[model samples]
Target: MTTKATTDDTAVRTSVRVDAAPEHAFEVFTAGMDRWWTRAHHVQKGELKEIGVEPRAGGRLWEENDAGDVCTWGRVLTWDPPRTFAFSWLIGPNWQIPAEDAAGSRVTVTFTPTDTGTLVELVHDGFEVHGPGWEGVRGGVGSDGGWPAGLRQFAAAL
Candidate 1:
């Protein structure tokens, strides 16, 4: 994943490129974000009940816990099949960062075909004034870290 510092702001942008078909890649990435997303790495680990995406603009990206409680992880901001999808990243209070300032961010995943394979890019944009922590989260949870493993699980499912 590519993590960059903004020129005139405290926000950060992160991206990743993957090798897979566009449709396949997109489907896998979305469907599998929960599977390979480390339980130990999540804020609602033992309590995590269910995780899923609705696959449409205005659809819900959510999770539930054993207590029959649920939370909105995000909403689908844009949904273009086989091409791209953008969602609100409401991982605020769920993260190690301070809740008061963790207003959350955006996650945009784009799929493009190349001569060799598909290029999957995941961008996490927006951050508070705290620089290193944001970068650390982006780097830790993206690319071959969390999402990639999820993609691999998705591929296996297919």
Candidate 2:
């Protein structure tokens, strides 16, 4: 079963269960990021070679391509091992970064132990600050190719 709740108007939330220990799940989600995160969702100029979450507070979540160009998606906000991970995701309007101003949203992922394995909860919020074009960004995230596909890939990797 999947449950989605929207809080504060534009925020989106989703949860999925994975058949793995919380430690393993978190490791795969963060460390093994490149193995699951879809390439189509990124905003980069060159072909992507690697994508990863830099596992610490204030660290960068980045995607690097074959041309040695790096595009940073956000900064890690919270990094609690095997439990919670949060970051600011800034892809800007229509997946394009602003030349002068960058507006970002927040995504938080939590891992909970369960009888079967682990429960992964994701929350993407803070859209109001993205300004007028926020609706487009919000819609994309709730679309088929967004969290649903991303979580499916993540679960499959486990």
Candidate models: Cα lDDT each: 0.60, 0.82
- Candidate 1, pairs of clashing residues: 49-64
Candidate of highest TM-score:
2
Per-residue C-alpha lDDT of model 2 across residues 1-158, encoded as one tens digit per residue: 34344434667777788889999999999999899998866677767789998889989888888888887888899999899999887876678643334667899999999998999998998876777888777778867678767888888888
Off by over 4 Å in 2: 1-8, 98-101
* Model 1's TM-score against the true structure: 0.66
Off by over 4 Å in 1: 1-19, 93-103, 129-158
The lDDT of model 2 is 0.82
Highest lDDT: which candidate?
2
What value does the lDDT take at residue 146 in candidate 2?
A: 80
